[model samples]
Target: MRWFEIALVVLTLLSGLVWLLDKLFLAQRRAAHAGLLDDGRDPWYVDYAKAFFPVLAIVLVLRSFVAEPFRIPSNSMMPTLLTGDFILVNKFAYGLRLPISNAKIVPIGEPERGDVVVFKPPQHPEQDWIKRVIGLPGDTIEYKGNQVFVNGQPFGYERVGDYVGVGSGAEMTGASLLTERIPGRPHQVLEVDRLPFVDQGERGAQVVPAGHYFVMGDNRDRSDDSRFWGFLPEQNIRGKAFLVWLNCDSITNLCKHNFDTSRIGNRIP
Candidate 1:
């Protein structure tokens, strides 16, 4: 489990313990000594715990099962999600998992193609990454000349224009912008010059294994994704990104009103 998750669990347990002890034992003791000098006073730790228990419990529930906020640290999802974008992920969109353990106990819905998801990479389990789902279990995925194919059907792409990056993402300027139609959804993707159909350590086509997914970055040439590593295990999935709540450029530009107002309330595609 992550450090933040451990902290939440600890806080919740401590607060609950204090509350239970006070209700079952401490309260009776205090009542019996009503006229004593210390009757009206309670221990500092108990007071603090009682005051914080409700608030902590609420936060734990919300963050563990309702939703959680995450900050974008890389441009792998450029054109769809930019760096520094603070996004909210729907925790229960796929299912409900136990806090800390992350063991799914309730069945909700499964991820679909074209859904933008946040997950722990199979190779780097300690880090969290976000990408767009390209292929589901039992489906064959392929990439050739900057084009994507799912189960032998090529996804349609229409060249829109040259993409001009902004803020921290300016390094990707001049990439070709195209509208990629993935069945029901059409989203923009950036592609640099076409490299080989299969680069070193990258596969041209492969069948997605059960309980796994094939994902890729919108910035076709820049992302280190399943193309380079491997499939994303379903158990490692955190949640589906649904909206951008805030955005700010890097620290170097923090003083120039770096807040991106236009992207603040944008919905994640």
Candidate 2:
């Protein structure tokens, strides 16, 4: 269950082997040895493959080119995304790519500001992290006083209110909420007032170079993101997160139990 994508790929690859064996040996040998090829009907192996080949191929294509499902596992995305939210990422929104290798075969578009994206961690490519795209290639990103400035322009922000957690986030209930606008993209950000803002300024303002990006989580105080590791390369981008099909972490007394029904069908900004 952990490596669902890997399992899918393995199943798909196995189907190819089954298909090959049925064609090279079973198809020809069954007629001579079993005399079933004269029945004018398909053999058992052929029938079995006929049922599974298309299904496996479709899974491979959709997961690689069209879309993919991912589960939120941490509080990094917090208010915007909870621990049990099952999200659908648009694979082709950024471009089409081959799975595992993740090599882009077509260039459709690139990351834009405020996009909630799923990308391989900069520190560990094997691990995937979901965060808001803060800076694009060649964009200067500066963080000071919990405010973000992109390309020397301070993005506008308005304090919304204190955040209240209903489920698992009950302990962090009184966090600050701010509506942030990053040029073209605008979204809500949560900050824990109890935590110092010093961490954001711990490292000097960073200049994002070409082909690289800066991303951060909504839970600014708790997330282990670009501030901790570094910038993410364009190739590591998986896709943009669009919808949350299900969210169930709160019922089990989990850490992210803030059940915000308003966020259920909310489109990613």
lDDT of each: 0.88, 0.79
Candidate 1 residues lying further than 4 Å off, grouped into runs, are: 194-202, 251-256
- lDDT tens digits, residue span 111-172, model 2: 88888999898577788889999888888788777778877788888898998875556655
RMSD of 2: 3.4
Tens digits of per-residue lDDT, candidate 1, 81-176, equal 999899999999999998766789997999999999988887887777899999999999988767888999999999999989998899878888
Candidate 2, 121: how far from true, in Å? 0.6
Model 2: lDDT equals 0.79
lDDT of 1: 0.88
